[model samples]
Target: MNDKQVMVKMVFDRWYALLKNCDTLLNSLTDEQLLREIAPGKNRGIYLLGHLIAVHDDMLPILGLGDKQHAELFEMFLKSPDSKSTEGIPSVGELRSHWSKQNVMLKEKFDGLTADDWFGKHNSVSAEDFIKEPHRNKLNIILTRTTHLAYHHGQLMLIKQ
Candidate 1:
């Protein structure tokens, strides 16, 4: 095991551990609880769940893995804040299913990447730009998204009140 491989492993470990922690927190909430806002009128627990799904779902194409599965979620969860009326949002059941499937698929793709592959530019970057900005790699996505999950995990704790 070389230094690069060890560093990559450490990052992946943090990503996986945080993801699992967030999943456990999300699972503890009931469907009714999910519909309730994390704060008085802020984003709902379920909205945050779907937002996470949509963001993770996007990583597939961004990382050159494959097309994302839940484009519809973007309108409700990504494009805008949680609405007072539940017009275009997916059901809590459907969001949970999508979240599970999206994570499993991403994990498979993530597992297959070699340490060298992790340092390669993602699909969204140009080869010229990548040459100048080598840090815009696929592994960076995992690091950033892990932090994102952690941020939401703290917000989710507010839902219990």
Candidate 2:
């Protein structure tokens, strides 16, 4: 592989590591633990999990995969207030199922992208603009989302504090 391809592979490996760490953190929690808040007024573990799933669901179409498996998630997890304000967020089990399904599918789709595709424009960038700045690519999207996941991982830890 060339230098760019090697770098891209490193990024992908790092993303997968972050993802695995998140899965490990979540799996280590009990159902009741998943409902605990980071702080008295902060979001719950389940709420954060749902929010992560919702954002990653969005990455589907943006990455040229397919539509969101749970479009309804936007309202509950993305747009709505935290678990403190939301009235009827899905149960922990349901959200866990969605998280598992959506992530598995996303990984499958992401794995299908060629090395060149990683350096190509994601849906967010127009073709003309991408041509002018090829650095704004799908790999950048993964980098952004990895940071997002790690941020939430920290919050997840606070539930136990």
Candidate 3:
């Protein structure tokens, strides 16, 4: 494989692996377990899952994939941290479905991109700005989001115990 192919593969592999690990841990937990905070005053497992879904959903637009499918989730998950108010949050089942759908959709969109496409600027950057900062490409988004996934995944582990 060429350099671009090799680089994309490496990042993609890490992303998929981290996602799978997160999914396994998430699936193993009950809704009650997820509702508890990873630590007092910190985010809960359910909140983290919803936050991840919203963040990944937003990546669709940022990566030039498509419009977000779960923008409504940003209110409870992204715009705010965990709280006593569980007002309009979706059920754990719904959140799980959303998470699954997001990953499948993302994988399909990501698979469509060629190595050259991976090197192209994501929607977040201007053409001129991208030229000045070539490192901020589609692959970099996956890399950064993967790290984000790993961070939350680690937090989710606290619930598993």
lDDT of each: 0.87, 0.86, 0.89
**lDDT of each residue in 48-73, candidate 2, tens digit only:** 98899999999989988889888888
Error of 3 at 111 (Å): 0.4
lDDT of 3 at 51: 95
- Candidate 1 weakest ten by summed lDDT: 81-90
Per-model TM-score, in order, reads 0.95, 0.93, 0.97
Total backbone collisions, model 2: 0
* Winner by lDDT: 3
Clashing pairs for model 3 are none
Task: Report RMSD for candidate 3.
Answer: 0.9
Worst 10 residues of 3 by lDDT: 80-89
The sequence of per-residue lDDT tens digits that candidate 1 reaches over residues 79-124 is: 8978855666788888888888878888899899999999999988
- Order of models, best lDDT first: 3, 1, 2
Which candidate has the highest TM-score of all?
A: 3
Worst 10 residues of 2 by lDDT: 80-89
